[model samples]
Target: MSSSGRPPARTRARVVRRMQRAVPALTKTTMARMQAEMDWFEELDAEQRSFVSMVLQAGYSQFIEWYDDARDRETARATPPLSAAVFGTAPQSLTGSITLQQTVQMIRLSIEVAESELAAVVDPDHAAGVQAEILRYGRELAFATADVYAHAAEMRGAWDARLEALVVDSIMRGEADENIRTRASALGWHGTGDVAVIVGPAPSDGSSPEAVVDQVRHAARAAGLEALGAVQGDRLAVVVGGVSDPDKAGAVLAPHFDHGPVVVGPLVDDLLRAHHSAAEAVAGLHAAAGWPTVADTVTSDDLLAERALDGDPAARRTLAETVCAPLNAAGPDLMLTLTSYLDQGGSIEATARVLFVHPNTVRYRLKRVMDVTGLAPADARQAFTLRVAVVLGRLASNQR
Candidate 1:
């Protein structure tokens, strides 16, 4: 063998000539065998099948040229690398139509056909030389195949990120429609369970948007949920699905945000209705700073008092409907008792005196308020929420 990793000129010429003569028949035989062995090949449409045939022919022709070049040191030095040249004749789209495993199987079949045909045609003295070249060429082809798939995977990941951002943005803007659903379908967002939205500051450490999204997705998966995240202005918004508990899901994602309150909206039916949750979460996020002791994962309902004080109309409506309307429906006595109890600084005796009833009666009415509204009067936070609801309810009545 020569230092250039080829047999001496005389022997190299014979082997190259034999390979050139055998390539056409070898390519035909290999394609026929591959079709017979792999059911997937037969399933491809005519256009795709023709494309595969072109790639097989190209691979064979390029291998012969590469082997001939290898025999001549100067030609080998002048030519592009064998791996790059082998796939250059075929379209990159072939990677999409063919799986990597299928591609490998095709390559193996081609090599086998080439070896068998060359062995029969070439001189017995030069068989070893031909076989060695086939092995070297096969290794280079395998590397080229791997590079193709790696590039495809990277392109796919980038496309997915852009699509995910668009979906999340549409949800936040309350513009979700069929187009948004189509995009989410492409992303495989099959969460048919509850969905919630969480809002907080974007990370301040200058991480790329993709990195931030990946971190949130990883955290969500760890907690058994699917998540879509985007950096909208200074805020990081994540819509988590398949979880009934927004607070629990929000806790998993809280660390991905900057140091601040992470507000979670109520759970909704699915991605299409996620806009309502997104709206509530954003409103709560804005109001969250007002409370000094706010929990890291505060629910939008928990922030109703602050949201109402900040003039959020939705919060006002929630207070009026969910809190005041129910109590008012229970009876004027319950409403009057609640108003007196809050106005009198949560004093049962004061409320009883104002209502001209026994203290036990006031306590009973308070329990009735809890039963009607789901808010306990004894808790300070619930007391504040009740007070806001009463004020908003009276104001709404005056306007009507």
Candidate 2:
């Protein structure tokens, strides 16, 4: 041993020379064996297979270089680390085609091939030393493979995050198109049913964007919904797909947001049209501050009056189209009776007297109004929405 406690230079050189000579045989044997033993190896296309072969050759060459240098403590202190250079022959895209486990299996097979060939080439006196070096090289290759995969995973995560943010922004801006659908597919968004959008304040604890998204996704999953979340400034927006009940999904995700009202929009048919839901949810989120007693997860439809009061034209149009137009089209009598009932603080007797009908007839018309507009005149919130829609409808009719 040298004073630095490394093998003598002559001994290291002898082992290195033996490994250099065994490279060609090692390459052929390893590739043949991998083709026969590994089922997935032969499935790669011609270019990928060629790249794999190149990787094997590079791995063999790098192992010899690393083993020889590792024996010399001073020379082994090189940077860029031996692991980073192990797969230098292959493009980074290779990782996308082959999994890390497959790579590690290939390395193990290559090490076996090297060990078997080295035993044949080296003299009995040096065979043990060479075998030990091959084992050490295998360990280094394993760690290097892990490093490569870890880096790949980090890059994939970053790309997925950017894609998710883009999808969310498109939905919020009501600009969802084919490109957004393709990107969502790449992110593995599997929502195929009713979709809704929820808006709330982002977590105030200064968590990373990834953590905030993960928290919202976890909550949404627990509620049996698929969710995609993004942080836009101080707000967190989550678009949930495959949800039949937006309010329930919002309630499940409410605790994950900061201390503010979490607003959910009405469900749309699919993600392609989720922008409508996103708009309503955003409008409701802005309008929610006015209702101190609002539920933690208030639906956008519940806040239609508030949203319209906040100057949201979409809310106004929705109120007019969904509430007033249907009632007006049902009949002037039904519309007048509903107006009278709401004006009289939902008193059936007063509405009946004003309309010159029995109280039961007024009750029957109220029920008819509920069926036509889906908003009952008795409930306070629905009544408020109906009244606003009536006023807006009258104002719109007058303008016409």
**Candidate 1 per-residue C-alpha lDDT over 1-400 given as tens digits, one digit per residue, 9 for 90 to 100:** 6775557878777777877887778877887897899999988888888777777787877777776776454543645654467666667677788899989999998888877787777877667767777787888889888997888788888999999999999999999888887898888788678999999999999899999999998888888789889998899999898987777888889999999899999899978899999999999999988899998788999999999999898899899889998998899999999889988999999888888999999999999999999999989989999998998888888999
Clashing pairs in 1: none
TM-score of each: 0.89, 0.91
The list of candidate 2 runs beyond 4 A from truth reads 1-15, 74-76, 352-356
> Could you give candidate 2's per-residue lDDT for residues 259-373 as a string of tens digits?
9888998899989899999999999999997787887778898899999989999999998889888888898988999889988887998888888999999989899999999
User: Which 10 successive residues of model 2 have the least lDDT summed?
Assistant: 71-80
Indicate which candidate wins on TM-score.
2
**TM-score of candidate 2 on Cα atoms, chains taken together:** 0.91
Enumerate residue pairs that collide in model 2: none
